[model samples]
Target: MNNKEPWLAVNLSMLFPGFGQLYSGKALKGYILITIEAALIVSTVALWVQGSLGGFLTGFGGSILLVWNLFDAHSSSRSGNEDSFETSRKAGKDAWLGIFLTRILPGLGHFYMGQAVRGCAVLVLYIAMNYALVLLSGSVAGAILGLAASIAYLAAACCLLYITEKNPLRYPLLHIKYFIAGMSIVTIITFSGALLVRTYIIQAYTLPTGSMEDTLLTGDHFIMEKLSYNNVDSTDPGRGIGHGDIIVFTPPGTPVQEHVKRCIAVPGDIVSIKNGEVFLNGAKLEEPYAKGETTYSGIEAGRIEGTVPQGKIVVLGDNRRNSLDSRGFGYVPVENVTGRVILLYWNTRQILKMDFSRIGKVR
Candidate 1:
């Protein structure tokens, strides 16, 4: 074999980005030791500059270039010493395989080939980045950041391929380890965040109709707190839906139609509708939001003179005539009640002075 050209490697590495140093047997140069390491920096800068997924163009370009540079350096450094390199290169087939897998699944490629530690780190970073994108600001800029950061992975894969070809016997096991570690970390984080979001934060729901007109208009976007009524333990399931709660529930008969209405009477409460007015416990319940003092004039369907069953609540809309509420379908059971509406955020065009009063506490 010819004597290794250490001087040539150094010159090339120093002259052409990562080449000269790598050719000089400085493995760190072509191995993403600097460029790959700078991935986090690029990501941070991109986020800081663009601020969201929409502004990721700068960072995306930088990332792709960075990855391309790394690959070029690796290729150029291996150009000389063809025979000696050829012998070393044959063992790298498995490493190339690892790199190939990394392209599609990030750290999984490495883990599949058995590089557990590196694969775990990559997987952790990947999951964290994706979580941040989903939770904070889901603009197109975040998408670009994700795309740009992916280039480092490509560089890592390229290097891994070369390394594996140099030592095929050891590459397969390392790749597999990386794949498993990456998958494990990703699975854990994904489910963890899902549980957290589902448990604590409010969810956005769209209101279709104007049953509760002047209060919750149609095309309104509102948020409902999930844990506000989840306090019912196994000891007492009846403690969920209380009186005065604006609940969303499906009536007993037509289970498919979900309606949102104010709960006026709980189980055993005496409810009476006289002259289109609601009476609870023999006293006239004053509704300030009702359009007028009128009874169900033509419709003889919903008026009731009965007691609320156990675990049921009588619900009615503020718009007495236009609404088809519990008066029509009967009372709603506590089990079908999902949660209470805490806020109202109607569409701007649907209501005037919307910007000034778009959001308000729900009745």
Candidate 2:
């Protein structure tokens, strides 16, 4: 026994991790770690091949296992030495303080175990990466990074468990500290992405009806720029729209309903609907797409002639007879103009019915 180098046992344990378990006659545990570590390595490589290298499974789980292995090795050192491994019965005031701070801050646990630079690096990297992920992809990516940091924390607790054999519950406040630290990462990430960073795309509306047919058809999904209507420029609706521009507007009576039509008459222009034809500025508007020579004029039956009011646009659908448009509901207020219909996405029933070759590009 005098010839036995117990420090060799410690060094070997520190080198390979779980070797300390082998030294303690727990060969089963040592083999388990080895098996798990190898399996994770293989799986990580396979996932990288499948193009999920940056995914949560690879980034979070791989990071955790790496830190866990390091901590396991560190704890295994000085395992059997009486002087070096002797644990205090009172749990020691300073030792408890170190553990407490480590619990409060990620990677601080490793620092408390005398791995200073590594601890600080881990803490800084974890925070910076988490912040970046939130900024780019919102909370989804940030949460994964947090879970990885937590695995490191678990490794530290497991090390302490190996050394002290004390109940972690006895350190209730410290346990809360670690729990909060891990949760703090996720909370910051979620809040920053949701409120501060603003990584989501703006909502755009699609034309769901054919009231604006020939310009914007039913089932045509067009992109409306939210930024265009954000600032109301009442003086010159031309700040956003000009002659010949197809505009989308919410009619005066219903705030939520949207109507798309071509701007034939701007503010102060006299507009008249006569014999089913639109007479704008004293000239019969020649719209090639207006299908009928005589409009049913039924939809706009009660409509009367008037000059387009200031800050109002006279918008009409190309389908003169069937549309519920400016003639039916009156002029559209300039403030209600959403944006010009930019693109036509997909016509729902047009798989083999491919009359329109236009698919993606804005009209």
Candidate 3:
């Protein structure tokens, strides 16, 4: 078989991460590329869980590998010095199958390409990362692992599939019609499932402003539980919004933007800020999360009525110096409350200031 198409190798590598190198018969290089990328990906995620700023810096290695793979694959394919691997392609494997298979399971595509040991190791690592995340921090950590796991699979698939064209298969490449139909189904299912989950169960929100700084920095993203707070009336119990709860809400006048803050006082509760100290119901509220100090001057500074107004909740920012909350906008109406923030979830900042340690629970 005249399977020496440099462009095919390039295209395959372009589709996956290390396929081009494998196609060029550089099996060791291909394996190294995939392994490094997978390791860096999981490492960055671990850094994130540990809340280190180094995650972003470490994650940059994957990009370097991407460029290196493309360049090396082209060079190897053009030269006659390629080391050939005699592995046969398993039946019915191609780029598309590799993509979805790797995307969903992280290493199944490698198994399909006759790299059983490599495939098993990657699969185990990916699954273990997610499982450990779930055990350490529940589903949100698992979700983060899901997002980060792409790097692992992309690199593995590319390396494995680069050699796929050489082997006998039921269908080495997906026909155009099947590819289109398969992609369409995947798109529809993913979109619909995500939409439904976000609408009824949970949704992610990013803090655009630094109002909730230190605790929730600007650009920090969080997961809000909607089942408990969505369209909830004022007098609701059980899933009730209470003091110390972080909530997403639209201040009375701003219908276009949303703000998140800690509920300092609920209906019929008193709140006062004295020189950076918050007094709740006559006792100074305990707040270790408060950034430095609070001031007494805004609409929130003075003595409130003996109780918070009915159907309203008093909210304050953890970073009181910068936050515009119930102090500035008055009490947040029950209807304006969007969702209760259940998790710190995700945080993204500029490369210089990026921190992942802040990703976790809010309470």
Q: In terms of lDDT, which candidate is strongest?
A: 3
Error of 1 at 237 (Å): 7.7
- What candidate 3 gets wrong by more than 4 Å, as runs, is 1-180, 231-239, 274-276, 298-304, 349-356
Write model 1 residue lDDT over 34-102, tens digit each, in one string.
574356445643343222332244445555655565455545545555665557544433454455466
Q: Which residue runs of candidate 1 sit more than 4 Å off their true CA positions?
A: 1-188, 195-201, 233-238, 297-303, 345-354
Between candidates 1 and 3, the TM-score winner: 3
| Number of the candidate with higher lDDT, 1 or 3 | 3
* Candidate 2 ranges with C-alpha deviation above 4 Å: 1-203, 228-234, 237-239, 293-296, 299-304, 351-356, 361-363
Q: Which candidate's TM-score is highest? A: 3
lDDT at residue 322 of model 2 (Cα atoms): 62
lDDT of 1: 0.59
lDDT of 2 by residue, 25-97 (tens): 5578677866766676567544432324233365467567645754454345334435522343224433333
- TM-score of each candidate structure, all chains considered together: 0.48, 0.43, 0.51
- The per-prediction CA RMSD against the true structure, in angstroms, equals 14.5, 17.1, 13.6
Q: Rate the local accuracy (lDDT) of all candidates.
A: 0.59, 0.55, 0.65
